[model samples]
Target: MTTSPPEPGLHEGEFHGGDLDAARRRFPNAPAPWIDLSTGINPHAYPVPDLDTSLWGRLPQASDERALAEAACKRYGAARPDMLVAAPGTQTLIQLLPRLLPQGDVAVLSPTYSEHARAWRREGHTVREVSDLDEIGTAKALVIVNPNNPTGRVLPVERLRALAADLEARDGVLVVDEAFIDAMEGSASLVPQLPPSAIVLRSFGKMYGLPGLRLGFAVARPEIAARLRDNLGPWAVPVPALQVGAAALNDDAWLQRTRVTLEESGDRLERLLKGCGCEIVGRTPLFCLIAHDDAGTLALALGEAGLYVRQFPEHPRWLRFGLPGEEAAWGRLEKVLRPQGQ
Candidate 1:
């Protein structure tokens, strides 16, 4: 399988109020909507913790920024402090990776997040895509999305270690974007393996259901981390985001509860989709990837019935559903797309 990066025009939670507005204009008396499943986020979002008012007013400076990152390292079990860097979101770090590693050919595992390729190409670098890590060219920079975004595939850590060693031998960079690894059964995280040629990116958005809060981090070798810091510059994350991220990361009890919820929800999702004659492909306790011959039609029918699901343009046959919150939403979905013959 050959992997190319995600093309543009594809996004999680894609919808235009403009489109809805147009639909409303065409049919002003349409029924109101209830829930959205466009993005693979937990519908039972973690309660937004109340923050100190000072967090909103205070400007994030270098000292507080360092503290925030250091706290994250501890939370993730990283011993070295220099390996971590905080950013507004994982997207910022992915976008900056191309600029940071300017001189090499980049290879990305396919059916993964599109941002990786999009960022590289925008910086005038051509990216090679591969379906499996074995097919990836020995380019100076190799990027992989652990528990991959769209397909939800997770690569083994031992395989990544071997790959990293090979890349290091060629003076290459091995970037493991672990954006969704927090939800995996056993993550092949490279946090314990940070060095000059190794890097990992993590997102707090998907894990904590705080996408609007926009918190993420990158772990790399000391020198490489410094370079990323110098290039990306100061005020990397706003004070409020930093505060919330730190609080959430430290809340181990909450995280465990969230994981349990994800597992239960994912099981229900699998059964529900299968009941509708859809095939389950890849999944974690957090989200599931499913395929149908006509995802577009299914998406429209579901949306028209007041349930919004995400449809992919590049892979027209697939649809990704976020874990729904209530039995009512599930009931609505079942009513919208009942069993093949019942």
Candidate 2:
């Protein structure tokens, strides 16, 4: 495997979690069967139902897309079908929104997801990284990742609603990314109480643990949704994604069970980390962000042991751990982490 020097800035997009090939080069002699706990993706993915042969043979029909959107609305509690626009992924919408809207100042919550800032900047918008919601004054657009990535900070709905109201007066927009909210309970998703000036982005892959499927939705008012649909043009989502996402969304039983299982798994992870002398700073059920004085050293150590966890260059003291998929994976992680405590 080829190896390159790690890039400096967080925006390189070259150092995201779950790049097993990169890990292999970094730890070429570590071991076989590396345990990947880097990304927040659920280890237990949804079982995709079989697809009709016609879905593969022909172009996706308008009705099939409509059915997928309808299912997403029902599943996500959107006010109307027209309010939601399906796309290949939420990442696509992130890159598209800045171009669709008029150029203006965009404020994003910092030490969070880097893509939002990168997307806005790529489209020639002035981007500010605000540490607090109150610091978003006069910005034409505000982006927040609810149950935030890496940190898992959840903003209250009332605060977001008020922010939306304030932004609406200036004809600005508030974008909430709910990619990690599916496994979280009592989350204040902007979908149900979606404001006219606010657009909420949801990822089907994160929640369903099928990132390869590449399905996501943008929940906004009718007009904005229509504009996004026009920009994406026809047949944006694949036929397999439409059918699979619909089935997964409608499976309430699996959703409930997965939530419980993830919660238990999170608690188990907390115990393991704490037992290994790591400080648990923040988390969602899907992953835990831990603090260590030398996180880079620890991450390197773990990588050498064939256990990969996420480390943020922006925050030198932090490392994030995703849940192991099975008992063997969990055992492997525990065995690797035990030496750190010693």
lDDT of 1: 0.74
Residue 18 Cα positional deviation in candidate 2, in Å, after optimal superposition: 1.7
Output the worst ten-in-a-row residue range by lDDT, candidate 2. Answer: 3-12
The candidate that achieves the highest TM-score relative to the unseen native structure: 2
lDDT of 2 by residue, 238-313 (tens): 8999899988998999999999999999999999998888999999999999997766777777788898788776
How much lDDT does candidate 2 score? 0.87
| All candidates: TM-score | 0.88, 0.95
Per-residue lDDT of model 1, residues 1-342, tens digit only: 232322232233233111334333433443566456656666666677787887777789767776777778987767677778888888899899898766668899987777787888789887888887777776888889887877888777778888888998998889999887776544467777555577899888888887888888888877888888888787878988877777778787888888888888889888888888788888866678898876666665665676655566767778787777788877787787674314
- The residue ranges of model 2 lying beyond 4 angstroms of the native Cα positions read 1-14
In terms of lDDT, which candidate is strongest?
2
Residue pairs whose backbone atoms clash in candidate 2: none
RMSD of 1: 4.5
